[model samples]
Target: MAWWKLHKRDKPGGPAAGGAVLASAAIITRDQVRSVVGRRQEWQAQGWDFYRTVPELKSGIRWAANGLSRARLYVGRIDPDGSSAPVPVDAQGGDMSPAMVANLLAPLEDLAGGQLGQSEMLRRLSVHLDIPGESYLVGFDDPASGERRWLVCSPSEVTSTGSGGTIRVQLPDSQSARIELSIDDCTLIRLWRPDDEYGYLPDSPLQGLQDPLRELQGLTAHVLATVDSRLKGAGIGLMSDDVTPASPQQSDGPNPIHSDPVTASLIDAASASLKNRDSAAALVPLLLRVPGSVEDKFKWFDFAAQLDEHLLPLRESATKRLAIGLDTPPEALTGMADVNHWTGWLVSDTGITMHIEPKLGLICDALTTQYFRAAWEALGIPDPENWACWYDTSDLKQRPNRAPEAAEAHARGAISDAAYLRELGFSSEDMPDEEEQRRRLLIQLATTNAQLAPAALEALGVQLPDVGQAIATDAVRAPVEISRAEPAIEAPPRNEPPALPIAASAVLDDGWRMACLDLAARRALARAGNWLLSRSGRSRRGELGHVPVHEVHMHVSPDQADLAQMLDGAYRDFHAATPGETDLHAAVDLYVRRLLLTGIAHERGLLAGHLAAAGCDRAAA
Candidate 1:
């Protein structure tokens, strides 16, 4: 049998012999679990080390780290109804006491591990979280204070039960003493990320990506190996034609036409000399004496080759594949030139929002459940279940490359000016104080009033107070008398109509206007119905007007009143959310477009119904 072929065969229709043999064997064992852990440890170490050398992996991990580094922690309460309320810090003069939330934040800011800062710790954890899809965060309680502190543990240091519900942690000590922890142990933080199936073991983001990553790695190694081999093996091969000695040398017979051995030795020496030459000339020439009358020929060969043109694109494809597997944008991974700056920002923001933040959120949730519950219980707080630990992700919620969007929103009254200012990069401290803001608002209001007063008086045909005379009494601050007398200003020509003043109550709320428009629409619908009924009568030929045998088109054309009513309805529906009255002509034009479409539909429906009835009547006849 061939090496690949099985030595034994089952029945033709039965399972494969090898598969049966494997199925009969035990799948899970203590050694197998340990071996799997060993493999994971190996992969983690290799993956981390590889990140430094691989640009794609480095970019992906750095992107995730930079995105998560912006996280701000906040202590908050999860209500019984699943709503959350932030428990404010007392340092900021919040209602809640500082002691309540400080316990959680303190340990987070100062983890038990090495001298790594909080940002550094998160960056490391984020890398492991993304690459491995799981990480173990071990907590150690203070011996005297009993406060909880955390240390990030390698996956290899932790072992799990068969069901994976319990974990055994090996302390990083000389003896490596181990401790068993239950599934709910607050000291153990297990981050399990499963894509489709739920299990204690999580699938890595690099799982499906390994093939492409390894391919890229292999291509890189091949390039390096080729370069190394080329540099080490680079040299020219020498070729010479065979020559025959004329005769043996007799010392005194004109060197007796050098013998073959003597000539060979001389040629070898000449070749070595040529190789050792270090002259400034571009080419070195060598002359060798031979024992034969035949001319000697020396040929030199070059060492070089044309590289494969397809390798660049193939390597790029592999990089893009790996990036896709990591949920990272190709432009981010490869610095793809085809992607514009705005597009790259959008793509990066999407990856951060949809993939990166959620992973960090999972870590936050685990920490919250473990630390917040314990801290609240230690503080004699009741129903600690309502409280959870969370990070502030408000900065990440902003739309990338859309700072102008905030300004537009402010202009539209969708957001406050303070929020707009913040979006524009002004910190809370940079904003004007409340007192200064109040003074600014007063000045703005006064200026607005001054600007509008002249327009209001002009509309009423009242002239402004003579500012020249008022300036004389400016020192006394006396009010100027209004001029009731009609000014010498000539009225508009008779051909030009005078503008009419609008009433104060001209502006109506949406609901009231919509109701009036609805009433008008209902009346129009009633009139249309009556008109359609009136058309169903005896024709001039004394036959049913709507009979199909007559073959007359039964189309309902809209009248001027009907069209006007529909325009009003469309106008009301379009501006249903408007805060006040709008320009009548503009509103009518906007509504007429929509009214024409709907009116056509309504007429078609009525005509179709009438035609169907007429067809049935004709068929009965």
Candidate 2:
């Protein structure tokens, strides 16, 4: 006989060859298995009850679940050297293509015969995990359709067999048949337990929270009872010794004349009448006839004053305790009245880091091992152990304002362009290419230099090519040229005509002239202060001559046509002489521009006195 046949055949008077063999008898008793299962069932029942009835607990779980369900699911490849974090499977330099990764994740979109989507499935799984401290996801090939289907099973619907890594789920059908699934078909995500020797049963998060939950429920009941008593209690009292006797004609049967029977009948009639009326009856006035009673006749008893003043504080404390027990932020369960925008973001971050992330990690690990790896192998993918399903929580985390920091870092060359954009909550895909970034930088640099004084440009060895036309076309094609040049001092012309007195000009009214001069003086002071601060060792040689002269040009640019027209109307006759300037508009524009620059230099203590003093001296001459 062949060796295989000999191994398969049963030996005479001995155990069968194909049967499972054990070295010794089972050490764990059947009673122990039953005890574990019973304890888990009990915890599950309590968790479901509290989750359904307790508002605080429900709110905490809902916050966590809703936030987690919004996260995106992706496949990431583990780094072999462990030098950095895992990268997405479709990322650059990765072996897998986008099409391949999509194929692997296609089943997640159509789970449970299209009855459940990825988000809904995640929500259900999160809810079950938080409640019972364990959740189940079962996958199997459908016999009729020949396609895989996944189902999220509730804790109450699934039971562990505790022997061979197997579980039984009771289907909710007419037959209620129990289906047995092995480790290959089901994944169980559970909280870590230090006492679980076999690792078959894990503890629930709600295990030690029974006292707080019970206290919350008790406090709620007490509040309801207190309010109920106040609403149904007496509001007023009438005390009198005189009683009115009933006449024989008014009484159809036996009539009582004592105060006790009369008072009882009267109270019953009032209570019945009030009960039949709307809530507005509480505001109505009550009149009672007590003859010969002047002292201590009517007294108001405040039943509402008997309510416990400390009830609200007690309930708030209980709710906070429940939130603490569940490892959630108190603000999430209660209200966000105490939280500001930044603190709210911090709370969300802390909640995800401390509570939600760990739970999601456990779930993703289970899914990767039980389902994703097998599916990838079936698709003939190599090295299945290198890739796993993961979640991206970027959506759940709120991005803070970091524009200033990002800009400073980029200007200092401390980080790359991609890193700076990412700090501002932008992805690398949104970043422009190197050539485009260089073109934009050049354009911005030229524009900024065009606003500087001519002496400043010459001192800095920079030149511009038609900035106005360049900006209008939104393009820069000419290469910038720089060369060394000797500084020359040019004396002011002695016979130049005095600048037209802007304050006394007839072209504009007093208000317009004053406004224009005031605006120019203010702009000059600000520009001179900024320019003086920007001076460095390389540009100090021409510091005195480098005063900015283009304040009016900025207001007259293409984007500021209205301001340009206003300036033209305000300074039509002002003449400040400039080299090679002939047009009246140009002369007036140059005159105003020089006045502003001179004012700026004077304010910085660069010049001896104000521009108005020189203009006045020239006018007197």
Using TM-score, give the best candidate's number: 2
lDDT of 2 by residue, 273-328 (tens): 45854443243323343655657576555444365788789888887778777746
- The TM-score values for the models, in the order shown, are 0.50, 0.58
Extract clashing residue pairs from model 1.
Answer: none
* Clash counts for the predictions, in order: 0, 0
What is the alpha-carbon lDDT for the whole of candidate 2? 0.53
lDDT of each: 0.49, 0.53
Best by lDDT: 2
Tell me the spans in candidate 2 whose CA falls farther than 4 Å from its real position. 1-40, 80-84, 94-116, 140-149, 157-198, 233-236, 239-292, 296-305, 334-339, 411-413, 429-621
- Model 1: residue 92 alpha-carbon error in angstroms: 13
In model 1, the worst 10-residue window by lDDT is: 475-484
Tens digits of lDDT, candidate 1, 195-310: 56656566667766667878888889877765543332223323344443323334555544344654544444344444543421113322333343433444443342335688
